[model samples]
Target: MTSISIRSNIQTEIREFLKLAIPLASAQVAQATTGFVDAVMMGWLGQEVLAAGGLATMIFMAMMMTGIGIISGVSPLVAEAYGAKQNRRVGQITRQGLWIALLLAIPGMMIIANLDGLMHQFGQAENIVTLADTYLNVMAWGLFPAIAFAVLRGCIVSLSEARPVMFIVVTATGFNIIGNYVLAFGKLGFPEMGIAGLAVASICAHWIMFLSLLGYMVWHKALRQYSLFKTLHRLEPKTMQQLLWVGGPIGITTLLEYGLFTTLTFFMGALGTPVLAAHQIVLQTLTVIYMVPLAMSYAATVRVGQWFGQRDWQQVRQAAFVSIGLAVMFLIVAAIALFTHSRQIIGLYLNLNDPANANVLNIGVSLMTVAAFGQVLDGVQRTANGVLQGLQDTRIPMLLGTFSYWGVGLTTSYFLGFHTDLAGTGIWLGSYIGIATAAIAFIWRFRGILSKKESRHPINGLTFKE
Candidate 1:
């Protein structure tokens, strides 16, 4: 390649990468903020309420992520089609994703609405079970709005338009926080419904987010040039099948990841209310900080998928590197903040009036410090996984995740915490081991794929038979 050709390619890759990354980062920030807001609001309701909110949130995550995972298949496919300049296919996949989301939400909402009986089956403290059930049932109605928003947002990702989704999420999260204040504390002449109030605020916020995204898609002229409106009439069965194939693994992958945490929560409840409460606080904090890496992963997925569609493997590699590098740097900063001020951060969520409950706050700070490095690794693995997914290399990473989370991680935690003297800290150790293993395996798999592909020159496109 000529010097100029090489320079041009580098510049184009950088520009494309940034075009995808900045918006994804913004969306990630909004997503992270939503978790932080949920925790902060719930924190105000005392230890029991905080614990209840956390448990309920886990169930919500499991249900939502399961369906959203399926819908996530739309992004890479859309990104690939957009890169290939296939306007009709982009529209078709987006439409199919929406339909799938609608169908998925029905069962999701039903499960949430009826989760109380299931919580009892898990065999938890009666009080904890009641609280979890109450919060889940009320919040179950949120599935529709949440799924709708994901469907629309996935379309935006396909088009590489991240800013609008970010705006919609940030605005809705802001309103949700305000609603939390009003509903949770009986402010503005409202009843102080505590955990239930938080659920109500969430449902209202999701509806707002859904409506806002739908409106933007309908009205934005700049977006219309991409044939987003005109191409909606065409739908192809083969293309729909491709969407399902790509999305199915992703849905299962997300369920596997979220399910690990939910299962952990179930176990935590059996340990005691104190441990459960402490874990919730730390989890909330972790979730907030996790948005940075999560955003980077999404960026990697979009950029990698697009480059793959364009048959630009070098650009895909560069995109993955840049995304991972940025994520590492971001998490390093978050780690420092956590390590230096763990106690202070925990204090913000702790109820000082209840001195007897100080153990919860103290344990949270200590456990969070132990969990910090793992969080950094988590950023890496997730972002790397996204890159692989973007390249349509999902099977290996999915298998890796399943093994790491279930085989290595959860099992280690059980053995260490119950069988040994590590107690709660041992549980966190399991996550670290699991994720670290996943990170190594994912990186190796991705690198191996890249190497094999490079050895076979003149390969023009990626073709997955299934």
Candidate 2:
């Protein structure tokens, strides 16, 4: 092709990626706002409460990602089926996904409810453990609803109907804020429940998001034709197996990444309350910014899945490259902002002037400074993982993630934090290496996949065979 043609194609690809990515990214930010809302509101309660809440939130997210990984199978399946014009198959996959969500929730609730023993085993302080236990016990009930919402979201997002999800998420953010205020502080005729109240608000928000999205899917003109609700009670072994095949690795991958951070939380907790609190603040801030690349990855999965379904290898590669480029560019900007204004950002989460909070504030600023270097790599790895998911190639990525995060990241963190004087800073530095390793591996894997000849046969009803 001529230079003009190549330039035009690049522009078109960028536009396509942005069209899907922008709304999805906004929705992700809105979803992340729940955590931000909890962190900030809990911060108002006190650093101890904030630390406990943050620890509980990280554990909750770790479990939540498991169910999310399982249900994520819906995206590529629905996207490919939709692209292939197999409307009935799309509906079947979604219905089965709900079953998977419900099944996962049972054990999830149990695990969360019984986290008290586990936290103690990890050497967490009794006070923080008590508060975290209270938080998890109440928040556990929300797991099923949250997983259900994720399933529906996967279907909607794969079909490229992300705006409604964004709308509901924005609405839920408002409800969460109101609910947190009234319940956590004894306003609106409710008893003040402290950290537990925050958990309750999160549960309420999850249910609202689930119900709203379900209602929209039922009523939406374009979506009604798929009849996602028609076979909700039925279970297909083949469909379930397919979902597991794709989703199990995704779950493992999520665990690999989340487990690393969760383990770091434990390490921070071991250091003391101030260090733990600082870690939470920096983590929450980075998570919010991380949503941009996360959303782009989701978009990549949808776009690549659809293009693969249509046997358009060129467009699939185009979508992958474009997504990676956008993720890198966005994260570069975020890294700059974080690096330049570390104290300013931490100040938003803590009262820097308060003597009690000074240590937490200083530690948080330092962590954020270290975090700035990793943001770009984090984006790249997350985007590459998303593209691979779209291509329906997950097992290798899972292996890579395991090695990078656990073998390289955690081992380094332990040696640095415990065996050396770097302490929390050492842990953060180790995370940088782990994430960069995963990013490099994923990008290499994706490029290799793109360079190979395209096969005509479909892989798992989603991707083309290698």
Which RMSD values do the candidates have, in order?
2.5, 2.1
Question: In candidate 2, how many Å is residue 199 off?
Answer: 0.7
State which candidate has the highest TM-score. 2
Worst 10 residues of 1 by lDDT: 457-466
Q: What tens digits encode model 1's per-residue C-alpha lDDT throughout 255-277?
A: 88889889888777767778888
| Candidate 1 Cα lDDT to native | 0.80
Error of 1 at 16 (Å): 4.2
Looking at model 1, residue 289 earns an lDDT score of 79
Write candidate 2's Cα lDDT for 1-466 as tens digits: 8999988998988887888899889988987978988899889998889989999999999999878997898999888888899999888999999999999999999999999888898889998999999999999999999999999999998887888988998899889988888999999789998999999999999999999999999988898889889968889989989988998899999988998999999999999999999999999989999988999999999999898778677788888989999999888889999999998888878888889888887788788889987888999999999999988889999999999999999999888888888888889999889999999999888888766634444243444344
Candidate 2 residues lying further than 4 Å off, grouped into runs, are 455-466
Please give the distance, in angstroms, between residue 364's alpha carbon in candidate 1 and its true position after superposition.
0.9
lDDT of each: 0.80, 0.89
Winning candidate number (lDDT)? 2
